[model samples]
Target: MVKINKMLKSLHISNYALIDTVDITFDNGFNIITGETGAGKSIMLGALSLILGERADIKAVRDSGKKSIIEATFEIDDYPTLKEYCLANDIEWDDTMCILRREVAPAGRSRAFINDSPVTLDLLSHVAMQLVDIHSQHQNQLLTSPEFQLRVIDSMAGNDTLLSDYRKRYAAFRSAVKRLHEAKRKIEQNRSDEDFTRFQLEQLDAMNLVADEQEQLEHEREILSNMTDIKSTINGALDALLNGNSNALSLLSEAGDYCEALGRILENADSLAERLQSARIEIQDIADTLSAFDSDLNADPAELDAIEERLNDIYALQHKHHVSTVGQLIELRESFRARLDELENSSFTIEELEKEARRAKSLAKELAAQLSKRRAEEAARFEADLRERAMPLGMKNLQIKVELTPTELSSTGADSIRFLFAFNKNQPLMPVGGTASGGEISRLMLSIKAIIADKMQLPSIIFDEVDTGVSGDVANRMGAMMQSIAANIQVMAITHLPQVAAKGNAHFKVYKQDDEHSTHTRIRRLSTDERIDELAVMLSGSTVDNAARANAKSLLNIK
Candidate 1:
């Protein structure tokens, strides 16, 4: 028997319900815990649940003023995959050990940590699931669930990659179908508005709108509206400069003649004469410009009417489109054109989506068929192996069958599975949940766990009184099965049966003690002599006797 390297090493719990503080160190192989009912066994499991990321309740606090904390330590050097997961999640990874801790404050707030680094509860749970599998009596009800049944078969078939591929294909198929449906809906809706959109686009195109056209046209309209005032202002400026200024050019000419006469007597008079001549030339040019303006300034009613009509058309289009600028109206027209184009090409788009959907569906169907074939082949072996493992636990007449019914393609696959069972010959097989009693279910679950333990490489498994309703040789056989499973991984069982308790490499007893203020639950590892006494008490109803001790020693294989 090879020992598993990755196993839970120790647990520390403090200030939790019914437990002030307790530190438990577990062995690597089969470890047994025995205690009377209500002796804090369930409390211990609850504390363990905290480290597994279960929701923390304020009611579980032993003292309302203090915080409750639970921590678990595991050796994980052999699990490189777990190391990779931690590194990928930005969690600090330890080479040889990983510690998981949960803290619940008195204010009902909770926090989780991995290797002392803060983490979300979801991340903690994801890592913890890979570390431990805690199977309780309540899980027996899962026998009725088809999902769980199918999961068990898949595990046996080693269908992880195949199932992942199938689900990916199925997801693609669903997406394609969704896109096709959306395209069809949009096409139908756009078809209803097609005529109106085309009309709007045609109207805007016929107008031949240009960006900035509205601003330019408004400036032109202002000039045309005030034409008489603008023309009068220009004529007044022209008369002041040249046309009516004593006629300024004539005045400048007289000044130049006087300066020419003075030049014979005075030297500066000649430069003054040149200046007056230049001034006369400037005035003449101004007179010529004014004359041209007068000739071109006549107001034509016909051209004004045309300009007003064009402006009115632009204003009407802006008002109709609720736009203030020609640019905005242009954008609206393009949007209408685009919508019409989509309506026209909708058939091609729908056809392309249909092809994609068909391709995805075909691939999904092929993968689902492969998954179904693998599941079918493994289902037979799983049934046979379960029958062999369960027979020694007083289920010799157990007739087990796996039924796979074809289902439509889904995330899991294209099959629905159920475990059918009958405990006696000539009895009709029915679903395990309906046919198996509580004890039978317990035994069956244990057997299933035993068969899958090696395949799963589970580091540790805790069975919380899974040996609920069996005794004598059946209990002994169940213990033997657990011992066999422990060879490959860590196994912990909390049981009351002496036969089962005697098979452990290490044993712990949970008990209650009372002080003056309150009662406390404590657990301690039992020694060799203490084991005999505990087993004797369990066998003889709290009374230890020579015969019970002999029976316990015999069960423990002591001489």
Candidate 2:
């Protein structure tokens, strides 16, 4: 596959550390950055780190009253995964370029943005991981990490899909096991509470609770308690309306007769008579209704006692269940019955879950075995490749082996991987960290990176003086390896070695400038002549002579 070139186009930093403001555009290939001790090369890397979602510190601010800003722009024309990542995360997407920015306020507050949309630090870190890989001197300690060792091998093995599949199977197995255990626990607990649950269900079933039954029973009880008053009132109303001598019905009838006589001589009198008739009819209906009510009002003491007892039962259940209505009590009763039913059938559920767990475990184990097989196959190739790459970098008698030991299935797989090394002939192999020197480790890291560069899918890698303990020919060889790797990806190196610095397609010099009150750090791209002078200075240390310039020209092949 033709790898898409995704490189950091430019980085802008302001009010950060010793840099008031610095903007540097990078090249697409090997880019070199060189500076004297304490000239702020690392500070520039620190600013870039902020863009990569490193933790922000208020102390990095050049001025306590001003906010520090770090922004990085990348060329990402054909990187579809990154575009998909932005869309997945709801970040604004730009087809050809991506901008990542970080701001740290004077109060130590931090914010990150992608394509100008706000994002969390974690998301920014994930996106930036695809854009750049920054290897510093401290990262050398990763050589001792088993996880890192496994990742290195996996990257070379091209096991992205297989690893993803194995992890999914492993996760399913873990979930199934958890569910099976929970089901067993639930069965045990329900067995302990079986009698109590059965008793509760039986009590609710005997009551046979109904919806709205409580309100209906309470209303019946109220009417029964006031039965005498209600009956007397109804009788009085019926008499006043119908049976009394001066009842409303009789007076309304007499008024209707007068209105009918007046209608013969007056126009509206007939309408008035009709209205009086309507009023009499209405009074008669009211008397009939009152009579029925009086007849129905029987003082049934037995029914009253029955209603009271039912209401007390309802209230007792409501209190016991912590409910306020008959509906809620009914719902609680059904829930208890459901729990009992589930308990009765719990053994079946447990059996099913156990079967599911066993299936999942079997599938995971199968995939783990396949993963182990592939890793074993790749381990031999990786061992040979590492030995070949490192042997050229001063490990003349290098003997490297990748140890893959069987382990219980984990998220990564069922293998524990370690890199064993013997830097001399007839030397017993030990773990790389115990056997290799700092310089040897550096070279091994570089060689590993070179082997996996095409697979990492990263746009750029910045080496922060990873060539720490090497000198002369080894440094030159490391630079050559970086240059070779850059043929397929962007490479940036910070070095004090002219041998390494001479190998870059573009060079930048970082230096300190002293003003009146404070010192400032500045970096600028170097011209061809300026690069030569800088190389001469790096070679001679504070003195540039004819021979150093000639040697610098010789290194640059400027004969």
Candidate 3:
């Protein structure tokens, strides 16, 4: 695995430059930050986290009336995922990408920007998760979350497909069970409502309604019943306009010709000529319309009687069904058919469902058993690995128990695993955070993290006061352990212990200085000489005593 060497090369902070605004660059391998109690040591870690999407304190921003901006330039190793992201998001990448986070503390609002583009907190958190794992002092407590435990077991199981299939089966079974209950309730309801249902079905069926045919037949009946009177009216109108002695076309034609002759004598007679011509055409059109109507108007008494009977049948059905339109009748027909189908086969469906549910119950129990066995094996190995890493962190006789037990019908197979432990062999096993002290919990969390680090594919691990409870030989062992861990990965620690602080390949110091009207935090990447001086100060407080400097100088680990 590639570790951060010259990565996170530079940092720039404005309006948030601590007591003394300063720009700093980092070195490779291990970096340690140590200072006096009130010297703002944790501020650097907090700023880094804030830029990584952690919410910052409202008052943390400077009173200069400008937004706080934290910009970090990084030289990342060949990370294909990050490279793909940069390309996709239009971020320029050349072995380096700039992540800039800005917080507008004026409105108590903060914004995170990666390469100067505003991003949502979730996206910032996702990108930050790929870049860093900031282990806060309180992060140790998150290890005991039940959801976290279940996630671990499922990850290790590597049988997610099988578990997915099991969950699908479980869901189907639950649905079947619910449906079966509803059907039974419906049957009981039908028994109580048997008389009403029989009455509705019988009444609907007796209507024997035809769907669109009823509306079509009624229109045919209306036309047929009026045929005789319609034919007589059309004939009389056609004769009056065409064949009568005073027919309109005969009178209009003579008048039109007379006006045409008068047009030669008078200017206004031109209008009369056009009007006469239009009037003759209107008379012809009226005669043609009546002729067509007369041809189409024939009366047949037998057909009229048949049409009337059809309409009566439709009206009778409508009255019986209590519906006003043929469309409503169509809907009633469909409803009747659907309910009839349901009543017909509800028995067969219930029988098949009962059989399938029993089969599902048997299969679920079988798979759950196999899943529980695998989890037990994984749990044992997991505990062994945790205890092995915990030994050097002042946790001798520390016992880690991965308790795998069956939960009641969970989608994730059947196993529920929890991290349980005891400080000594004879002591009862208690949860990592509940019964164990803070120091013990911290060590346990570190041990667990160490055990999973390689598998987790994490390149850098930041420890915030991880050495708070350690002392003497145990503290010395921690320093050596961290150095060994650093040989393969980058380890940065915020420590008070000289052993841990002295073990880093690089060191920095954070301090606060007062100005004319305000306080600011200043951080400097310490050189060998500066580190030694700072370590001396950390060891002896205000008096740097020669022995502390000598101790700082002599401590070194191989690259």
Give the winner by TM-score: 2
The Cα error of candidate 2 at residue 541, in Å, is 6.7
Candidate 3, 1-559: lDDT as tens digits: 3454325666677666463355777655667877778777666766777767787776767664777766666657667777688668765555555565656565678787777677777666676667666676577657888776766655565656667777887787777788788877776666566666666667656656566877687777777777777777777887677888887777778787898889888888877968977887887898898888777766778887886776676666579779887678668766656555566777986788788777776777677777787778777777777788887677788877788777777777677778888887689888777678777777766666655544444546677887787787777767766666665556777888887888887787877878798777787778777888787776677688778778767664312
After superposition, the stretches of candidate 3 with alpha carbons farther than 4 Å from their true spots are 1-13, 16-30, 48-56, 69-104, 109-133, 153-204, 214-233, 240-332, 358-366, 424-426, 457-461, 480-491, 502-506, 514-517, 532-554
Cα error, candidate 1, residue 255 (Å)? 21
Badly placed stretches (over 4 Å) of model 1 are 1-8, 49-60, 73-132, 210-335, 457-459, 487-489, 527-559
lDDT of 1: 0.89
TM-score of each: 0.74, 0.84, 0.70
- What is the lDDT for 451 in model 2? 90
Worst 10 residues of 1 by lDDT: 239-248
- Tens digits of per-residue lDDT for model 2, 423-462: 9989999998788887788788889889988886755899
lDDT for position 134 in model 2: 87
CA error at residue 346 for candidate 3, angstroms: 2.4
- Each prediction's number of clashing residue pairs: 0, 0, 4
Against the true structure, candidate 2 reaches a TM-score of 0.84
